[model samples]
Target: MFLNTWSLWEKEPDYNSYLGLAENLDEKGYAVSFGDNPFDDDKVGEKVYMHILNRADKYVHIITPYLILDDGLLMALKYFAERGIDTKLILPGIPDKKAVYALAETYFRTLLNSGVEIYLYTPGFVHAKVFVSDDKKAVVGTINLDYRSLYHHFESGTYLYGAKCITDIEADYQATLSKCEKVTYESIKKEKAFVKLRGRFMRLIAPLL
Candidate 1:
């Protein structure tokens, strides 16, 4: 006999607010690891989706407060979308850092045009970095879809397979949809010039964020 344990990572400081996984576990499911790989660039962002999300036949879901997609991850998303994968994003409508939000906004048009569905969480900032695909797999941890998180920060996430919490993540996603505003090309274009300019400036300095 073996003891099963699961370690989950979160960007939030609240101990009580981590993902709810109790009702979703079973004998076959086990713990996903936690901690950092300090020596390497954050390859978790690239690999998580490359292996898990790319294989989804239903949908690829993401929930994060801030977003800044690099070339490789962006290309991977486009590739997945082109193959008919429903790649959807849920981001913060109210971000803690305006500069990061501005930077994230600059890429809205490109992503929307490339067929990625973007949603803004309307009630508050959503700092959770979670990814779920086809309700079969999930990655929950500290990884973010930005240059700093993917290339600089020492981050990690737990990769789960055949876990019942995959559905819980999706259910959370659906609940979030009710509080979200969808992004469109026209909406991106409609943003004020000053805001757009700020986004461009933020983009230049994004690697430092």
Candidate 2:
């Protein structure tokens, strides 16, 4: 059964609900959040990475128009691979911002090495901020992997457990996979350091950039 595609940000997830997932996971010894504000050091050694990793359920479907592999998210992804999670990352192939695209590549290499599959949505901007784990839970809204979306933007997302919506989200993620290029560690290491540095600089002001 295929569920029709719907816009993520346009759909908009409830703010409190997204944060609730974080708190709930924390109680269960997992910590993840929707927005940035990484002030809770003891609780959140990593940012919203638990949003991706703490799911030992089925699969993790992530849709972010823009993405970067910061330390927090990176560590969570590494953990996901160790546990053999069916990891799928869907990002934008036709990048609107050249610098951000470069930075994403840097993260792509790291993610690929950790056994996390990468997918790039080429139809458009692919700016849907959402994540679904094993069809049981899903988050969709405006959050991203960059520091800005996490630390700045007042983002929102949803966690749905229904059948119709879950199927559609999975289908879209799989569809985008067909359009993505598989990244490798070799390619990442071979990338130009100068370009990578430029991307990092951009990340420094990613919220405003």
- Give the TM-score of each candidate: 0.82, 0.68
lDDT of 1 by residue, 111-178 (tens): 77778899998898998888888887888888888876777777767777666777898898889888
Cα lDDT for residue 122, candidate 1: 85
Candidate 2 — worst ten consecutive residues by lDDT sum?
Answer: 1-10
Best by TM-score: 1
Could you give me the TM-score of model 1 versus the true structure?
0.82
CA RMSD, predictions in order = 7.5, 9.3
Q: Candidate 1, residue 49: CA error in Å?
A: 3.0
Report the lDDT tens digits of candidate 2 across residue range 1-209.
11222222323234344434444332222212233234532222122336445744667877777776567677887778767888878778688987888767766766777788876665657777777777656656566766666664455444454435666777777777787765656657787889889877876765564
Candidate 2, residue 157: how far the Cα is off, in Å: 1.7
Per-model clash counts, in order, read: 0, 3
Shift in Å, residue 94, candidate 2: 1.3
